[model samples]
Target: MDSAASEKSIIALDGWLKSPAGIYVREWEQACLDELTANIFGYNAVQVGMPQIDALAANRMPNKWQAATRMSNLDELALAAGNKQIAVALDFAELPFASQSLDLVVMPHVLEFAAEPHQVLREVERVLIPEGQVIICGFNPASLWGVRQGVRRITRSPYLPVAGEFISMPRMKDWLKLLNLGVTRSHFGCYAPPCRSTHWLNRFAFMENAGKRWWPYLGAVYMVHAVKRVKGMTLIGPAWNKKSASASQGVPATNRK
Candidate 1:
């Protein structure tokens, strides 16, 4: 049931992405993802979901792939018809890639709408090699947009997709920590009020500057870059063992006295 609901949610969100509001949201997230993945060094990079925007456009990884549950042709994606990288159909909860093979994975607005967001993340984590990176883009629920969404829900209308369970930044960070993925950096954008009219949106555009200067972290959306860290890697030195033995000898000798 969750999977079916998730699929329906994604289909609805995909339709929403074609709207003016969705375009507004995409502009901010696209620029953020481009910069975050541009200079990142990696061999195998994959972008899961949201083929409308090429998440790895700026990334220079030798091998790149886009995996999604639904069909997305080359015409819709930046991956040209003849390009080596092609979009593949796969479930987010169960990725087809081998374990510890991917160097980088981009999830643009995938988690917020996923029924099994944690399981989706676990699949990404499984494919990423130790120290590998994953870039996540999502709608922030602590901003003006979030407030607006709440108001919409009361009126039986939602500005954003109603099916999505928007995760907060701190909560997202916690989920990553649980999976051994440490958030190295994050960015926020889309400060202007969500409006249908281009004029109204443009008039409030100045809020972008003010919002960044005054409340940078409270943007309408955010992109998080986290790296998988393997702990317990520090090797104990023989000298430390010898020091411990000496310290134990002192305690025994003193006890005898």
Candidate 2:
């Protein structure tokens, strides 16, 4: 609910929407949207970023109502999706909504730019029901795009105006665990390369397909589907046990007891 953070997020989102890479990013985002729409476990859903695009992609989903927020694009997209409920605000990393109020939360590249990713993810966990699903799409820091960024840095030139951390899937998985969420499935793709000149490479689909199946670690982006675990679930970890001595004679006890 920080107004300043909200403004920054809005500005960043606007810039991204106007970028060439944003188009490809949106295509990847649509993949997540399609999955979410197909699995509406609740009557209400909320999209955290790029509400307009999400609404457009999720137009056919049946829900009592869908709400989207982030910057000012909510209204137009909501109208297009035939949804009347809309919330205009920012700092989605720290949502103002009540606990377990939403059943589904879709984040498209929201984590890559987040200054405090863990905080944002925890907030997402807070707002989702126990069974709610959080679908996230983020850039892979260890992929071809990552290599391109490294080259840019080496040459003292960068594609993105603002530099942020490129999070890996393993790191994100750990973050989810800290928030008591379990990752059920993950998909990685965008192997066509990060250069604008290589846009035609996407038409083949073979690169992305084979890359995801055979070389997930090298995919440019990754989509993860995580479900919030019910509170108080017992988590088992490694256990270390040592033999105890008998109280009477102080004799060493066996491991059997």
Candidate maximizing lDDT: 1
Angstrom error of the Cα, residue 50, model 2: value is 2.2
| Poorly placed runs, candidate 1 (over 4 Å) | 70-84, 87-90, 234-257
In candidate 2, what are the lDDT values of residues 1-257, reduced to their tens digit?
Answer: 24455456556655765666666666766766686567555655766655546533543434433334454555466664454355554555667678988777777667766666778888899888877888887778788778777788577765543445678899999999888889988877777766554356456457776886788778777888899999776767866443332343364446335
Give per-residue lDDT, candidate 2, residue 256. 31
lDDT against the true structure, each candidate = 0.84, 0.68
| TM-score for each of the candidates | 0.85, 0.74
> Per-residue lDDT for 136-247 in model 1, tens only?
9988999988988988847777888888899999999999999999999998888988787667877888988899899999999999899999887664665667777887
Model 2: colliding residue pairs: none
